[model samples]
Target: MNDQYQALYQTFRWLVPTQFNIAEACCHRWASSSPDARRIAIYYEDESGNREVWTFARLAEAANQLANGLVKMGVGRGDRVGVVLGQRPETVVAHMAIYSVGGVVLPLSAQFGPEALESRLCDSETRVAIVDHASSANLLAVSDNCPALQQIIGIGFADERVLPWRSLLARQPNEFKAVQTRSADPAILLYSSDASGAPKGALLPHSVLIGNLPGFVASQDWFPKPADVFWSPADWASTGGIMGALLPTLYFGHPIVGTRGRFSVERAFELLERYQVTNTFLAPSVVKMMMKAVPEPRHRYQLALRSIMSSGESVGETVFEWCQSALGVTPNEMFGQTEMNYVVGNSNKRWPARPGSMGRPYPGHNVAVLNEDGVPAAAGETGEIAVNRQDAHGYPDPVMFLGYWRNEAATQAKFKGDWCLTGDLASVDGDGYFWHAGRADDVFKSAGHRIGPGEIESCLIGHPAVANAAVVPKPDTERGALVKAYVVLTPEFAHRDRNDILENLQEHVRERLAPYEYPKEIEFVDELPMTTNGKIQRGVLRLREEERAQAPAANTDVGAPLVAPAQQPET
Candidate 1:
């Protein structure tokens, strides 16, 4: 732990009073600070480069109107409101309005299918849903199943039954007195599909917004001030997007640029340059896409990016090298999940990052690598990474989730006394830096040795020819399971001779890892399945492998690519 951050962490609790509301604290307070304040709240743009701007006053007024409108529709405090929208100005307004009226906001991803949408709506017992035209049909399909859902407000289009957003807000007053709520009141419900194999809702309290401040302050690579511009390619529905990009930046009264429509790498670069964005957060996959989309970006655009933060998945060495050369700064890797915001990360401003490590625990967060007996693990010993629910002095980690919504048993299973298990495996070094060893469930046994896919996947991704890689266990009668690799090669290496490439990659892994840890089988694919949050869906891959194993005349190699080794033409 860095001693320098102790003072800041201690002072963070006083920032939010006991009776607090997220909207009143983050929005109304700034808008009403002065009569002539023209502080820009949002700088938005569509796919074609058209721009839209919102001042703090304009934002608060719009949110107030919506809040009042919801009240008129019989929605009030404690009711769950679902927000199914994209990263647009309306999305921000919806979030603020929901909280202003004291309604618990359930953020749904725009990419959710009809079944997924139905499952969450029914589970949360949502009374109202705010959606854009793109997601309107999905919500409508599941409305019948969700008996509690009474109203569906459409952003762009509306039917006889569905209400129009702009028309409804126009009828309501532009002023609303926010409901007073305690810091422990529920604020947001994030649907997370953790190791349990099913979606579970993590209920976050209003204090969570303030709880994240310590991590934000401790994780800054460039130390964002009140005036810096913030933008991110991550979806707002993801925990990192809301905590890292939207909430913290907004709390500081900084202007943020929201992306709309499809995310083109060229447009992203344009936004960074046009907005003169000083700070930004992106998932590692987005960084890789940008690297592929613009090979020599430094020569094409003048980027004023002061710091870059990445999370959602483990970042590899290749991406780090690409960032330093292309963006002129090292991308700070942040680690956390929906259950907890950011607990560990590299803050270059305070402490220099140990390359490829997860960095130290943020101030006020008691993070440690623990063994099976619930004791702290020694340096270089692999164990579960956990955060103490409360410090030795009885200071609770405010950033943690209140509990898994409506699932008391699941919540209880996640903790051991004061330590809350993160379900991730890692090792602490003598210098206090943590190294990721993948999820505990992702670790499989092969030949009496526990193998983590993360270490192997990271090693494969470090190869210059490989664009991405995922490792899974293939059923083996002798070893119980053998390592099988799914690889996506870069464009430059895609058309090369497969035999040579496979041999070279196998040799590469063999040299870096143990003899048995090397992938016994390699299958090249065009792309891998990914979740809404940009994480590779290994669950889907594992299921496919199981189905293939049970197929008629099933080859020992599961889900082998249709294209054979000789099918590749020499390039």
Candidate 2:
């Protein structure tokens, strides 16, 4: 390990619960341990269909080559490099390459189109981009427009002008000088979902994430023994998937299982059994789908699963109970968001599980239920969840991000005196654990995505037939909330076939967005209920969805709009 890494490892020992750098720990484990310990694989049986594996030794070597290749291509300390790859072994290598050089990693979705890719690249002023062979074209399309994108490398396909990954060993220098990076240096940048305006990059230092590991391990039961396999269904584009699962895996030599295709309850179980995954992080909405879509009782196939951890939304009470009873894996639900990061969790280790508690705040961290005025709320009073900034422990050392990349004004506004204001509303009971209330604004969860209802409604209103629109999350077991849009169509849209119109919009959006982001359903109404000022009442629409979903009978209404072949949006 470099001096910088050694210093950090020591710092964590004294200050952080996990006393070692995850990257160094993984490298030493892979090099010195038995060959069996080095065995790791990324299962992709969904689309390509089969078992493909990579040995730890092989991955370590490949990552070394990729790391050197990144350096040779002029990537080094403090530089920003964007990665666009599928959930395969190479994805992990890309992370290693960037970190080894002390460069910051910016992981984007392989599914982002040219336009979305351009937006992120420009905003961060990324220096290098590594894309999957399939997405190289998108990078090339945006590269010229993004002057700061110095080099574009491909993971799978390589040309004479474009370097292929296989040549990293042959063309690049084998000897590399790994930068001894510091705790405060920017190590990762994740762009938040754009709800208010443009997406803002969340810049995080290595120390910020490293500090959360002890609590994470305790809560998720991630350590002591290396889990046989680890997985997180969240996309690499999002920060949760990387920090909450991927980075932690590097702390221990554990193989991870991830699917390159859409998440299926059956496929997830199959992968778990195939890889013998012992610990995992998932969105609870996935839990609902597993029970609904699987053909038979899965407990027989789930012996490999020992821990089921979740976040991005609350662990609905029903799903929490079912997981313990059915899968033999109790749900470890955590609560917090991109701003204040890790606040509370069942700590994954706490048992006799509380009905609604997200567990207590970790040691060194101080949490309080603050009223609208930022003062501590009275006992049993619901208030905005706030993080104490000046506690003797100092934000628990590592459970915080550096700051939002460039939005200094927004940052200052959210912090009131010494507390980091979590816009999330919650309440603390007499016992000290926090209970989640609804969001403070329009942002909500549906189908595992932190969706912006306005974005969906905007697309609906674009159709010539739609004049006004309102969208809301209808709670469902499979996906905590399902997107249900209510639209007031223009007369021209009514003339078109309903089925035809829905089909066209879905196709249009599929072409315009990442696949997981598409809404599951859409509905049309004569007029959206609104206030006197004409602002659509989203709360009222949300209630409408709740009432209909709870009707005392079967809810067979699957209202997906259809489109005629003539006007179907191109994908």
Candidate 3:
């Protein structure tokens, strides 16, 4: 609502070119721009402390070689190629190679099990997979079921039946012309879970990276500052990792640090200190874990982090304050989905960031809170957060995905007229900042009041004893439903008397939030269900509560005793 923000939004323009290839823009051009072509692109370290550095020259050459190899094997434009690797150097190389050949890149998580791998590969009809040792077995296990899968290229492991990554590159020419691709050509096929837990592919165009720039730059506090080193532990398989962190950093011709292993708080701190990382994109779960593991990171490790962008879930006020006091930086919480990402976020430098608010729409995006009838909701009214296909200037938004792969009906259903529905619910204040209510599916009605899990979860997370929490509606006969919370206690508080902890949590919410919003029942659990991308699976918890209600011997006590330790399954 301020004049400065209004001016910034009004002056932004989209400059997408007719011919654009992600590989050319992120790698080859940077390589050829400089005479030496020796600018560092990646600094890689493994769990065992093995280190390697790749310059733009090396990345481009490797991509060219791989592109040639893939082409010789009959892979062409529009063909699907899977990159099932973690945050290693080859992951970046595989994406570049896929883009260079105009093949659709399918970035799969290395942590996926056989069933998950089969679902995505078979759905995408992936022709070839470039994988590391960790993911090779699971991919191979499902390859027989995926008839379209023609070849498997393995890295860091030997198998006579599989093509070695090095051997394939060594036999191919080191220089090949990258296929000319239009800005609207399909570049990536990212699989996200649907309502039924099945994977649906969202095909992103080459211009998707261009679309992500404004929000990325703003969230990272006007990124690419002098010598700005970037790092993120988010998996390269997801949008937050690749689009939000990797591709954006690479587009600016900056070096990004990657480590191959499970993320630990200690390792994260060490890497930030060792690399002097100035910008990072962390998920809310990672931020919370860091807050719990190290209350004061700056005290133990030397850091130069200028900006931290957190998404995937709301970075609650508790975590936001911790970042300011402990990390010496205010984290910008971003909002978007796999189909359309980085649409809404906070930029503390440009405008004041309201903690727990998913800031205003990024420039070049037309966002609004839409009611069920597709009309924009008035201020302070809860509705679905949606983005228009066109910007304020009536230009096509480059950041929007092409469509869900081969699922035209589902794609059509995603939009209400020109507005693409995000399936997330929020309310805009008079000042235009979006306050998250909850996921549309996650919000529930208790008595006559609609209850959103986010506000209660945020309140629970602020409690010192609670490390993380998920709020869900518990089925009730008299009251229709009741607010129920699953709490994950901090290590120090895990073994404390459960009854006392539960009572304390109930009172904490009752004193802070509305009495009706306070959890009527609390369950202490070892951990809540989480997605591979670190989002709490409130759906899973909600389903569990529904099942419990249908049981023959269901407990109906409003003040029931705390349940014994139970571990929720991973979603």
**lDDT: which candidate is best?**
3
Candidate 3: which stretches are off by over 4 Å?
1-3, 442-571
- What local lDDT does model 3 show for residue 98? 90
Per-prediction TM-score to the true structure, in the order listed: 0.78, 0.83, 0.80
**Whole-model alpha-carbon lDDT for candidate 3:** 0.85
Alpha carbon lDDT at 453, candidate 1: 76
Report the lDDT tens digits of candidate 2 across residue range 308-368: 7688677777777778777766787776666545557764444334655676665445678
Cα miss at 223, model 3 (Å)?
A: 0.6
lDDT of 1 at 431: 73
Q: Compose the digit string of candidate 1's lDDT tens values, residues 422-503.
A: 8889999987788997666665655333456776787788899899888887765445568888999999998998889889
| Candidate 3 TM-score versus the reference | 0.80
Provide the lDDT at 245 for model 3: 89
Write the residue-wise lDDT of candidate 3 on 1-571 in tens digits. Answer: 3435677789999999999999998999889977637889999999899999999999999999999999998999999999988899888889999999999999987766665678788889999998888877777777889999999999999887689999999999999898999999999999765433355789999999999999999999899997999999877887888988899999999999999877788999999999999999987767887889999888899999999998765677888999999998999988877788899988898877789899989998999999878899999999999999999999999999999999998899999999999878999999999998766766665543435677678778989999989888887753557899988899999888989999999988875544567899888777777766677877777777888889848764433333324444553
Order the numbered candidates by TM-score, best leading.
2, 3, 1
lDDT of 3 at 425: 92
Report lDDT (Cα) of residue 2, candidate 1: 51
Clashes of 1: 0
